[model samples]
Target: MTDEPNEIDGDLYEHHHIVVDAGQDLLRIDKFLMDRLPNVTRNKVQAGIKDGFVKVNGAEVKPNYKVHPMDEISVMLPEPPRDEELVPEDIPLDIVLEDDHLLIVNKPAGMVVHPAYQNWSGTLVNALAFHFQNLPEMKGNDGRPGLVHRIDKDTSGLLVIAKTERAMNGLAKQFFDHSIERTYYALVWGVPEEPSGTVYVNVGRSLKDRRVTMAFPDGDFGKHAVTHFELIEDLRYVSLLKCNLETGRTHQIRAHMRWIGHPLFNDTTYGGSEIVKGTVFTKYKQFVQNCFKMMPRQALHAKTLGFIHPVTKKKIFADSELPEDFSSVLEKWRHYIDHTD
Candidate 1:
């Protein structure tokens, strides 16, 4: 409904001190903040907690900390400079579906979802700010307009935007409930052992590198994540997969796929950039390299999204075609297998 909260750079962004209700039940502080913070995502709140920016009753608390009755919660974060504020840019958008209440856009790969510390311009948020005026503002959202969720910068997909606060609430609830239907097409290395199966793991920020997420199979840390994968095509050394997310944690599909020994194709972050399968011959390596050049980023696409309309109270479903790089690369694989075999 409103703009996304500003990035935490240096200046004080926000300072909130709230006293828990006497009847408050034991709820994770992260979840507590989700309901209290204006336009802030769970990941942001978790980051604050992880970075010691969040405290309970004057004591630093982890994300999983429980908020008890009469407890005091404080969150103070550094704000980006005034110049760091969002700047609308004139960027082309592939809008898939649009209505008075909401719209679904097919986001191309290589576009950041919103402005952050380094990427302050040329983001989807900036485009929305430019093309529309007076998008419903959610008090202290900082400024993403109506965006609620986001995909990775290099992962192309269908994303929904709300036009009103009512729509925002409705959509947010659907996401929280895992009732939103989202399916992704991921080109991964290695055919899975099973033609189709589900991967259940706990995914969280790597204690080693906070920027990237990883899987914690022990379930002691991180959030519960589930990704149901069905093998769609087998390309010998590689495979095409249809991944249905049961819980949408950060990089859930990527993390799960990597942990399951099938990292996405061309996903340098998760180690798929190398020739995970196929011969170690120079020519085979060159072929994989050529494929990587064909699709420079992770070979993943958000193919479908379905949810209940916020205002219309009806089911809305939309599907997106694979982008050029994805389709072309897949075609190349098809051709390679057809001829090389």
Candidate 2:
């Protein structure tokens, strides 16, 4: 029971409960939620209010409802409206592990995890639709079949998909509890001041620029996010980092690293596309441009994922080798660093 909202923790939202303070002033429920739930727009709260996902003392409330002291409030964020049915595609999936209850897919970069606006086709969900016959049996959060969690379209990684309802609930609880082990490899533009450290910060959507995420160092806004980072290699202008997520906030790694002035290399959204380091020589600029072309995306990959098997009650751990694009660019950086002064 709390008012804290994880604004961008993957696509899963938590059910929240709260009790009004003893001496609270009367305030609009929507505004109150907006203040408590950082990075959420007023309209979104109002929408949830309209959808009857928000209740006070077990009764649905209107957007204009005022809060009173001792009132018990509960809220559940609803999924966005789906305009079309998911269509299965013949896209090949690199399944790493599979059992009766669950399967782990090594998702490649550039593949959307589920159907959404502008990416309504050729998603991992679409492939799941094609591969499974018992579609009705695999429903998960937001009707995304078998999906317990997701990574970004450009962030390649391991994903565990539940094949049964029991599996789904079990895995979802692990994610909610933050017990699932997840680690990523990222090439950032600069080295951190520490070889290993944790970025304990709040990440939420920017108030001024809504398209990207911003860090709240003072915890003044957004959801709590923690990314543990260790410098795996220092390549002069760029560095290879191993990032372990303690809390899976939306853009946690990208935003947190950038906050400390080391955004993921070639991450255009986080201002990593430009050369943040290196000399202002024409040759250096050209070399970086070539590396960007070689990778053609952010230098981030989900390298390892581990969790307890939902039904088997056994531990599951999966690791993946770096993709060609990611490894090749690393080679380029390594060579360049060895050759340069």
Candidate 3:
């Protein structure tokens, strides 16, 4: 509701101290500050915590430190001359479904879900902000509003966005309860050993590599994730698979598939090499290279989403078509299958 800039930047430094109230007890230090200081980033807050700029009870604490009621909280804020924040771009959107409470969009590849370091502009949130003009504010940070779920930056697909606080709360609850259905179409390097199967794995932050997520077992730092996949079509070397998300986690589909030894084609982040020599895809190597050259991201897309409407209580379903680059790759795969098989 407030048009406050989500981030502040510059050289003005100021130190402030405040007493925590009873209602704020057990709140994470960074999260509490993120709520109070609308313009500061979570990274900045964590940095301050690490540099001992944030203190509790006169002692320096980590960002995840929980604050109790009546504790004294102190922070040193650097006032950066604020630049124009997150200017909305005139990016065209594909609205698959829209109602007073929610909007389902076919998000194209190459668009970031929200703003972050080095990506403060040209995000889907910025475009929504510009187009909607009066989106309801979420309870969390000021950066993103009404964002109930997210899709990967390079993975194009259907994304459901809430328009009202009630709707947001309800939709978030549904997702947390695993009541919503999300299906994706992915083109991978090979067919699985089984025709259909479930990948039950724990996905957690990779301690060695922050950019990549890994699937591990119980008691690890990762959360439990389940993906049900069925083989839709096989192209000898590559296969088309339909994936259903039972529990959504960061890179759930990609990481789960990679963990099961079926890394997506051309997904370099998860150990997939480009179509090279000596594989069944030798004949279409040039075509694959051209498609990868033109495609900005991966060949994954959220194809369908189904949920009960928060207000209407009616079952709703939305679907998105594959982008042109993915379609072209599938076309080549079909051609290869026809000739070879």
For all predictions, the C-alpha RMSD in Å is 6.1, 8.1, 5.2
Candidate 2 RMSD to the correct structure: 8.1
Off by over 4 Å in 1: 1-82, 137-141
Clashes (backbone N, CA, C under 3 Å), per candidate, total: 7, 1, 4
**Candidate 2 clash pair list:** 8-250
Give per-residue lDDT, candidate 1, residue 195: 100
TM-score of each: 0.78, 0.77, 0.78
Candidates in order have lDDT scores of: 0.86, 0.86, 0.79
Cα error, candidate 2, residue 143 (Å): 3.1
Candidate 3 on 139-204: residue-level lDDT in tens?
664558768889888899999988888788888889989999999999887888898999999997
Q: List, residue by residue over 105-209, the lDDT tens digit for candidate 1.
A: 999999999887567788998999888766665444556788878899999999999888898888888998999999999999999999999998999978656
Residue 267 displacement (Å), model 2 = 0.6
